[model samples]
Target: MSREPMRRTIRGGRPYFFADPAIDKILNMVVVLGSEVWTLRERLAAFEAIQVRQGGLAAGEIDAFDFSPEQEAKLAAERKEFIDSLFRILQEQVEEARGRTARAPQKPAEPVAARKRAVPVRGKSSKTAKRRSRR
Candidate 1:
C-alpha cells in the first residue's frame, strides 16, 4: 500500500506536519490522548450497564465501578508506554532531520496542501437512477 509523504520544515527541512514542530507534536498527543480517553469512557459505560442490570451501587460508591487492580496497573503501563513511544518517534525523526540538514542545505518540497485535490462525490444510487431514466 502507498503512504503519504511527510511534510517538512521550510527552513531546515525537518519532517513535521505543521509549520512549528511543537504544534505538530501537541496535535498528535491530543489525538492519541483523545482516543485513549474515548476507549476508557467506553469501558466505563459497559461496566456501568452491567452494574445497572445487577442493581445500582451502594450509597457513596460512585467511584466503585471498574477494572481489577491488576487490569488497572496493566492499562496504566500500556498508556505510559504509548505516550513515551510517541515522543521517542518524534525525537528520532527530528534528530535524523537535523543530521541531514547539517550535511547540506535541502531544497523545499511541494506545498502540503497543493499535493492533494478534492475529488467529486459520486451518487451511490446511480444504477437505480439510470434504470428509471431509461424507462
Candidate 2:
C-alpha cells in the first residue's frame, strides 16, 4: 500500500459528523492518533520478538531498564511536546474564536438612520436560531 506524506499542521475547519462539531474533531483526532500508536506498538513488538529470537533480550528487560537523568529529562520534554501537538487543534479553535470576537467589536459604527432593531418572529425564537447556528 502507498503512504501519504505526514502533515505538520492542519488549518481551517474540518467536516463534522455530530451536532457538536468539537466532538467530531476530537473523535477524529483520537482515531487517527490511536491508529498511529497502534502501528508503533506493533512495530516495537515485532522488533522485541526478533531480539528475543536472537538471544539478545529477555522478557521484562525493557520494563526493568533505568534511564539516566539527562535521558529522563529529554524524554519528559519530548512527551510534553507530543501532548501539546495532540491538543493543538483545540488551541487553534480557541485562538480563532478569540480572533472573531476581537474583530466583532471593531466593525465601523453605523449612522442612526441605518441601524435597525431586530423584530421578533411570531413562531420562531432567536434562542433557537442561536442554538442551531452553534451546531
Candidate 3:
C-alpha cells in the first residue's frame, strides 16, 4: 500500500517568514523557554524516581538507599532558576510579538470626502454600477 504525503494548511493567507530583529528575538526566547522546560521536567522526574526508590527501601526490600540532601538542594535551586528564566523568556516573547504586530503596516486611510463618495447612498443609482452590470 502507498500513502500520500501529508500537507499542512495555514488558516490565514500565505505564511510569513519573520527576519525582523524583534521576531528573531522572540524565536530565541522560545528556544530558551523550551530548553528550560525540558530540563526542569527531567529533573523533577528524576526526583520522583528517587523518592519511589527510597520508599521501597523503607519496606526492607532493598538493603540500602542513599539520597544526598545537598544534591536535592542543588536540583531545587536549578529548577527555580529554570522556572525564572522561562518566565523571563515568555515575557520577552510577549513583548516582542506585540512590538512586531504593532509595527505592521495599517491600511491607508481614505479622505473623508472620498469615503463618503465611495459608498452608494440609499435610493441612489450610480452610473458606474449600471455600466458594469451591462457588461
Candidate 4:
C-alpha cells in the first residue's frame, strides 16, 4: 500500500506540499512566532485603549492618579523598558519583512505647514499714528 503526502491549502487556493522537514519546521516556527507577536501587540493596543478611555496623561496632574512617588518612578522605568523592547522587536520584524540584513531607520516626515514661518498681518504703523496724534 502507498500513502500520499500531506498538503496545505492557503487562502482556499491550490494545495502545496513541503518535502523538506527543516523547511516545514522553520515555516511552523515563523507562523507561531508571528501569531504570538500579533497577540502581544493586540493586548498592548487594548491596554492603550483603556488608557485613552481613562483620559490618558492629560487627565489631570500625575498625582491625581493612584501611585506614590517611588511607585510612579518604578512604573515609569518599567514602561520605558517595555517600550524599548517592543521597538526592538518591531524593528526586527520590519527588517525581516523588507528582506534587508540591516534595518533602515526612517526619518519622520515634517508637516508642510509646520515647516513654513508665520507671516505677520499688515497694520497701521505705530510711528505714523504717533506723528498724526502730535499734529
lDDT string for model 1 (60-95, tens) is: 355665888999999999999999887996775466
Clash pairs, candidate 1, are none
Which residue pairs clash within candidate 2? none
Q: Which clashing pairs does model 3 show? A: none
Error (Å) of candidate 1 at residue 41 is 1.0
Better of 1 and 2 by TM-score: 2
> Which order, best to worst by TM-score?
2, 4, 1, 3
lDDT for each residue of candidate 3 in 1-135, tens digit (9 for 90 to 100): 799887786667653368666786688789999999999999977766786677832433233644489988998999999998869857754664454356654746556897568455522433335446899
Better candidate by lDDT, 3 or 4 = 3
> Model 3, poorest ten-residue lDDT window?
56-65
Candidate 1: which stretches are off by over 4 Å? 1-15, 57-135
> Per-prediction RMSD in angstroms?
20.4, 13.8, 20.0, 24.4
Q: What is the alpha-carbon lDDT for the whole of candidate 4?
A: 0.64
The worst-scoring run of ten residues by lDDT in candidate 2 lies at 114-123
| TM-score of each model, in listed order | 0.31, 0.46, 0.30, 0.31
Instruction: Mark the 10 consecutive residues where model 4 has the least summed lDDT.
Output: 114-123
Question: Which runs of model 4 end up more than 4 angstroms from their true locations?
Answer: 1-16, 57-135
Candidate 3's clash total is 0
- List residue ranges in candidate 3 displaced over 4 A: 1-17, 56-135
Query: Candidate 1, 56: how far from true, in Å?
Result: 2.9
User: Whose lDDT is higher: candidate 2's or candidate 4's?
Assistant: 2
Worst 10 residues of 1 by lDDT: 115-124
Best-performing candidate as measured by lDDT: 2
